[model samples]
Target: MQTVCNIEQLRTVVNAWRQQGLRVGFVPTMGNLHAGHISLIEEAHKHADKIVASIFVNPMQFGANEDIGNYPRTLSDDQEKLVAANCDLLFTPTPEIIYPKGLENQTFVEVPDVSVGYCGESRPGHFRGVATVVCKLFNLVQPDIACFGLKDYQQIQVIKTMVEDLSMPIDVIAVETKREASGLAMSSRNNYLNDAEKATAVNLSQTMRWLASQLASHNDYDKLLQQARAKIDASGMKTDYIHIAHARTLEPATQNDKSLVILAAAHCGKARLIDNLQVELD
Candidate 1:
């Protein structure tokens, strides 16, 4: 894979692909390179002729007390994985490259409502950071399609909302959430878990699945949410939120809503993990 960190080089490579009339696909990530992330790259392959993946650990998306300093950077390992995944291009821009005048001075993009509640509530300014960096990357990459993991269901909603609100030409797609044999949603943060915490973390996904199964026949949203939250908390993990909401809008699911998603987040040992399950009621 061709690696370019310079903005001009990235544009030059992408523009060449455009001139060749080759449809381009993009996957933006914070490089720890796991199966879930690779799945996004593979998803991109299905949509476009060439795939471009970016690895910039966005500081704006991180909270003040979050693990910005300690977030793992395995660029060498990531590059090898990307090449193996058949990624055509990789952009590894530094914070300086992205925010030349500094983050305080850079223009920010915020998508309202969808950016509220859930992770947005738990981590203030988080979605604003997300929208801004993604907007910046969208402008930088200018791909025909961009793929995000379903593990971040709310995040994909935020991005889809942003794209529609801004009328950006890019198509945003969500790849299915990759999971372990035990049903744990695969995440880069999963690395933070110790052996015992790793085992316990699977409970988060399991609880979501259990809630989805129950919601199939019973639409008691509040009761199911409470039960799911209780199950995760009982697993020795602190529950952040276990909410049943509209699959597309991220609003609280209503009785008339047929398409729904169970969104969840929790803390296990040193890692803060998130997962979701989508269900369509009859």
Candidate 2:
């Protein structure tokens, strides 16, 4: 795979591909590569002629106390994985390269209510950073399609909303969440979990699944959420939020709501893990 750090070089390559009549697919990611990330690239292959994957651990998305400096950077290893996955191009830009004018002066993009609660409440200005960087990437790559994992359910929704609201000419595709054998959603942050914590972390997904199953027979959103939160907290993990909300809007799910999703986040050992399950209420 050809790896280019310069923005102009990336645009030139993409422009050349466009001239050749090749449709491009883009997957934006942080550096720590895993099977889950590779799954997004694999999905990208199905929709577009060429795949362009980017590895930039965005500083803006991280909060003041979050793990910015300690966020893993496995560039060489990630490159090997992308090459094995048959990715055509890898755009590995430095923070300065992305924010030439410095982050303070860079134009920020926000998507209002869609990013308000859930993870948004936990990490203030997180989705603003996400929307801005993704906008920048979308503009730079100018791909026909982009793929994101369903594991980050809120993030995918945020990006979709951003694209539609701004009228960006690109298709956004969400691949299913890849999971460990024990059923925990695969995440780069999973690296922080100790062996025991890794095993315990599976409870998060289990609780989400349990909540999904309950949605069939139960209509009480508050009670269901309380029960789920209680279960996770009893497991010795600090609960961030365990909410049942409208799948698309992230608003609290009402009795009349047909499409609903159960989303949860928790602190397991040193790692903060998030997982979700979507369900259609009858």
User: What do the candidate models score in CA lDDT, each in turn?
Assistant: 0.92, 0.93
Give me candidate 2's TM-score against the actual structure.
Answer: 0.99
Which residue pairs overlap in candidate 1's backbone? none
Best by lDDT: 2
lDDT of 2 at 98: 92
Best by TM-score: 2
Model 1 whole-model lDDT (C-alpha atoms): 0.92
Q: State the lDDT of candidate 1 residue by residue for 68-98, as single tens digits.
A: 8989999999999999999999999999999
**TM agreement with the true structure for every prediction:** 0.97, 0.99
Query: Candidate 2 residues 1-282, lDDT tens each?
Result: 899999889999999999999999999999799999999999999999999999999989999999999999999999999999999999999999999899899999999888999999999989999999999999999999999999889999999999999999999999999999999999989999988999889889989988898898887778888999899999888899999899988999888898988889999998999998999876
When summed lDDT is taken over every stretch of 10 residues in candidate 2, the lowest stretch is: 216-225
